[model samples]
Target: MPQLPCQGCRGMCCGPVPITESELKRIRKYVRGMPLPARSKLEGQLRFFGTCIFYDQDQDKCGIHPARPAVCRAFGLHRNLVCFRMPEAASGEAWAAGEPSVGVLSADFVWNDFK
Candidate 1:
């Protein structure tokens, strides 16, 4: 499948990725012994518009792409569920029109299927 232009994406899909239990466990394991701020971000305690802690704004990519959560990997598989937040995508209007809402679609997809 053709990949979305996510490299320079404004991180429209980085917000509020509802991870599975196993994904959470993996994150916990990865964040264990890390600094408090990093841990808190991973735990969804320090989000800005629900953006993922691993999203590197400067690089416009996932900091932990190799070990990213299932939901993150499954992103863009369902076009209707994805909000292309690029300037030309007109994403704000799409969201206002109710484009499944962030995290809602991720919650619906089974983690095992993506894995």
Candidate 2:
């Protein structure tokens, strides 16, 4: 699959990510395992309103990428999750959650939620 041109976009398309229970648990574990300095840096970033809490604005990528939710991993590869900058990357059918979402990352969850 083609990669989205995520660099230089600065997480403009990453926002309000919906997370399932397992995804939340995994993210919690990942955040807890991160070194304080690194976590602090990620949490300290001033992202645009509604941007994903784990989006590393300074680095222009996901801060907890390995633990990101399934929907996030499927992004830009489904009709519904198209990246405007790379619309062609999206194909096939729209994405649907395999599990019920516990909450949205940036909205219902926050920096303190992971800590």
Candidate 3:
């Protein structure tokens, strides 16, 4: 069988991702000494939880990505090369219309096959 082109496909799946132990640990470490988020509805809850709790929005990337749990790290998001083409949010006043207008590009992940 042919291998799935993960690199060619950016990590843009539609749903919540699964978390793992090691990744969760890494997040705990990052949050242990960091300050609070710029905006949060769960201020006190975060104190108990630590870290961004989940993916950080501002970066348009994952806060705990490097140390993210396996399931999350293994996300097969579709890669859209043009940075500004994709809108970050999809609800309320932030709803931007349609898919990104940027051309697509493929990348190679040595570890893509590992999972």
TM-score of each: 0.53, 0.95, 0.35
Clashing pairs in 3: 7-107, 10-77, 10-78, 10-79, 11-77, 12-77, 12-78
* Candidate 2's TM-score: 0.95
**Rank by lDDT, descending?**
2, 1, 3
| Deviation in Å, model 2, residue 61 alpha carbon | 0.6
Every candidate's lDDT: 0.51, 0.89, 0.33
lDDT for residue 60 in candidate 1, whole number 0-100 = 66
Q: Please provide, for model 2 over 1-115, each residue's C-alpha lDDT reduced to its tens digit, 9 standing for 90 to 100.
A: 8978878988887889889999999999999999999999899988888888889988889999899899888989999988888889999789999999998888998888888
Best by lDDT: 2
Q: What ranges in model 1 sit over 4 Å off?
A: 33-48, 83-115
lDDT of 1 by residue, 1-115 (tens): 4456776665657765665456655654555545766444534433355565566565566755666676566555544356354333332222122222223322443222222
Estimate candidate 2's alpha-carbon lDDT, on a 0 to 1 scale.
Answer: 0.89
Instruction: Show the lowest summed lDDT stretch of 10 residues, model 1.
Output: 91-100
lDDT, candidate 3, 8-48, per-residue tens: 22333312433334433454565443555532322222211
Clashing pairs in 2: none
Off by over 4 Å in 3: 1-15, 36-53, 77-115
Worst 10 residues of 2 by lDDT: 4-13
